[model samples]
Target: MSAAFFSRDIVSLPPSSPGMRIGLFGGSFNPPHEGHRLVSRECLKRLDLDAVWWLVTPGNPLKDHSDLAPLDARVRAARALVAGPRCHITGFEAAHGFTYTFETLSHLQKTLPGRRFVWIMGADSLAGFHHWERWDEIFSMMPVAVYVRPGSTRKAAVSRAASRFRHGRIDESDARLLATLDPPAWVFLHGLMSTLSSSQLRSRK
Candidate 1:
């Protein structure tokens, strides 16, 4: 499976409906698992999103490229795991030649200007978000919904971005309003946690 085969056919796909609230959950998906589904499902339930797009990246900039599985294999595995109408497994970002999460979100915002988009991420990613390229721009582009993974809540809350934008944290009750709110608004959702991780799964292979 190579990068060439994994890119998505974004142009041919129908445009998102007006007022559609979508969650963008981008990652390597080296091998998608229940955790991915749990997070997306929880976001859909709590954030009132119409769908969750699994933007499977060709590889993560922060991670070691050597360990990444081929993009096509990862896309197939992700499609197999997230088998649901509301959960879309796409290599759209890879197809568009966007490697970074921030860039992908920007592109999506422009491409689907009418639809509401919320950035979905795990607590651990939130904690290390500052390391991402143009991370602050992401906050300005759309609301971020952080799913609380076990052992990452406290540390993530104390992270630089959280502290810098302390005023952005919204109550769980207000989470569903995230898509409509201004950029920088975010919420930490406590949902069903899964211990599974791609790193651990890869190690076993």
Candidate 2:
């Protein structure tokens, strides 16, 4: 996808104020589904986040983009599905030409220094997180919250990234305080898993 696609439907990020706890949920979101909403809601409740940002990226460097959807279309779909005063959708990654997770996250921390931001992801993502660029630095930059995805808990829990950061893991009972904690902190939230995924939906189509 080209930056032009994002220019067509640049989404405004959710309102943020100093000291507010926010969750940054970045993904291609080629086709937003109920699972995405589930993660956002869980983060809002578990992390005590003031808002959740659904970053609709232009593409994922780790995945084949031969069949990826247009950025504008994906952003529109995300906006329609993730309806909530606290939920927001943005294609800023495309707008700014950020090809890696670290770049986008670094920008967020630099620009929104006053906000307490937590990186949110599902167990499925965590299972392959080590493959992500600057994966470890992500933990050092801000806190993380991983929600259980149906059938992915075991793999994620034993993944390399998890093993490396095991000492930084916090008990689920401390979830609400995750955003306020210092770097290298994370919590694994259990219950209410979702089996839905964009790839599954596309394959069915």
Candidate 3:
């Protein structure tokens, strides 16, 4: 099935006022789990964001798609997990046919000007962020919040993206100020931890 099948969910953009701080949390979310929720809640509280937009993608270009779930199903699953007016789940990537985070983020900033956008991700994704298209540009376009994940702290810390942007890393104590900071600013958050992962959940199925 195509993303068009869920026409009602192909959101143009979530409601927001000027100066609203929104966290752009993008992922395949093959099976949205507590781990995903943890990152969302952490970023929301720590970054003092007004909302967290979960950009459920069509598929991850860096991973095999043979096991990827249908776009509509994944979006539905995400909606069921993330609630409240502040947390939004969107399949716009599938609807707009965007396969790159850089493009999707750029589109959001262009269409929704005057909003503070921060890119949110788990440490695991940070470890391989360099493989993404124009990954460096993504850092240049918005502030970033990386939550520590099980067994990925060290790897993510020494990651190419982390090392390259080391000078821009801010202290976690100033996390609440992250949304207000300029591009290239990032902070590594700790405390919340979950062993749950989409891959492990998929394996059991």
Candidate 4:
């Protein structure tokens, strides 16, 4: 399917149950592509999540917003790319007025206490997470699952956040258990990496 399918008012989506174990992959999907789908699929297969939620952010705090497409447009693009019973594209934060990852996690945790939530991200983001607002609070709130993206594995391994929380890294085989672990736990997944990126896609456009 094309990338135009995700364009919808996320506020209209139904609420998720608290019994589910979900992975939240938030980003400014200016244009969703195969890379985003691949990483999410890998996260589901390896981490055993019930579903992967693509939280299309209004804008990423770390990146300039000048190039970002309209939030609804990006959401639609993401929905079109993500096709499966296990995947969901949402702009819930926009409806909830959550502008930061830490706040989003906090809101979800409080709203759905029974569901286990894991923060899914690529190595590149993990590497720079230390600079995120309330970065330490995120670590203390939920288990993080980091997937190795090409060219980012090495730098992420030695990143300040990784080094500081190195003790929490678990074996790849145990990655699925991350959702059950206490806050601050994480795992590094190694597998096929997609070379496509949003920046590269935008530049070509």
Candidate 5:
């Protein structure tokens, strides 16, 4: 199961269908759980996407690499938990040797043409997103959906990125059209908040 789960011989990885409205949900996915599943489903439904790629990254620049489990272990756990056609778990970052979000997004844009990709993340991530490397470049590359998260609505709303791009925010009713819009566009989804946090889950261990 371990050998086949990752099969490190992979190069380039399989591409998604062209013109597919895909959501790029990038993360370490240190431990797969129901909350990640719930977020993907909600993003798919709200954005009217054809599929959601859970980009299981090799490592996160913002996180301590030593604190994370082995890449294959994390990917295997993700593969085990993610089911159905719309949800895809790909270790593209690890396979392609990409580490940062900007690098991955740039690669995807060049690799998959005609495919509309939207960056998806919880509100808490948004609140601190400005601190990320080339964070502004990320906004310029794709539309972002800041899903409502427990206790993060206010902080995210007033975040540096949100404030800088406040004018680019569109109504929730127009969420389905996010992929069609240009960069600097984003939407904050309210009332769809989830109570799950990866850190919270890890703490219980």
Candidate 6:
């Protein structure tokens, strides 16, 4: 980590300020690959984001950790992938000790105040989002942008969060407006996707 980056309250995190459009993409990143970058690229172009931060989590509360790689190793693998000037990889959740999505976002908001934060996820996650801890609070905390995945589009659009917040759903054409919108606001984007995931990658070994 650079000395300048080490200056943040959240260790090794890149600098972001008020009014910047930042997309938060959180995950285990056990072996971050091109698929992750593909989504980031789409988010940057379509959402008009200033940056996309990959929140490399320490562990997933709902996932089995038996085959999970070390956090440092995962971060290193993610760092090896190509990213645009604005994209970043960070272990902030582990550095700052946050366990849940809602708590993580809340802490980031407090530390980096006045900035627009968008929760980025794949439609596959939406299908099972109801199982996350304090999942609804996550929706109410920031604007969300979910992109269609290879096999999860229909299931995601009909998900619990999708149904409950149906009125909050924004049209894809208006995606550029998400960063400035209030909480409970989200949009479902359709486009290119990768059939890759950490679990899938690990199973191949």
Q: Which stretches of candidate 6 lie over 4 Å from their true place?
A: 1-11
Please list the C-alpha lDDT of all candidates, in the order they appear. Answer: 0.84, 0.88, 0.90, 0.84, 0.83, 0.87
**Which digits, one per residue and each the tens of the lDDT, describe model 2 over residues 1-205?**
5676445447555568899999999898878998899889888987888999988887899999988987888888998997779998988887678899899999988987799999999888999999999999998889999989888899999999899999999999999999999989999999786788899999998
Query: Lowest summed lDDT over 10 consecutive residues: which window, candidate 2?
Result: 5-14
RMSD, every candidate, angstroms: 1.9, 1.4, 1.1, 3.9, 2.8, 3.4
Candidate 1 per-residue lDDT, tens place, 1-205, comes to 4436543552123347878999989888878888998999899999999999888787888999888877767777887877778888777666667778878887777777788999999999999999999988888889999999888999999998898778988998998899999888999899699999999999999
By TM-score, the candidates rank as 3, 2, 1, 6, 4, 5
Which 10 residues in a row give candidate 5 its minimum summed lDDT? 3-12
**Model 5, range 78-176, lDDT digits (tens) per residue?**
878987888877775766667689999998899788899999988889999999889999998999998888888899999999999988899999999
Residues 1-205, model 3: lDDT tens digits = 6656767755446788879999999999999999899889888898899999999888888899999998878888998988888899988887777889999999988988899999999899899999999999999999999999989999999999999999999999999999999879999999879999899999998
Residue 153 shift from truth in candidate 6, angstroms: 0.9
Stretches of model 2 off by over 4 angstroms after superposition: 8-11
Best by lDDT: 3
How accurate locally is residue 38 in candidate 2, as Cα lDDT from 0 to 100? Answer: 88
Model 1 spans with C-alpha error above 4 angstroms: 1-15
Best model number under TM-score: 3
How many residue pairs clash per model? 0, 0, 0, 4, 0, 0
If both were scored by lDDT, which would come out higher, candidate 2 or candidate 3? 3
Q: Which residue pairs in candidate 6 have backbone atoms (N, alpha carbon, C) closer than 3 angstroms, thus clashing?
A: none
TM-score of each: 0.93, 0.95, 0.96, 0.93, 0.91, 0.93
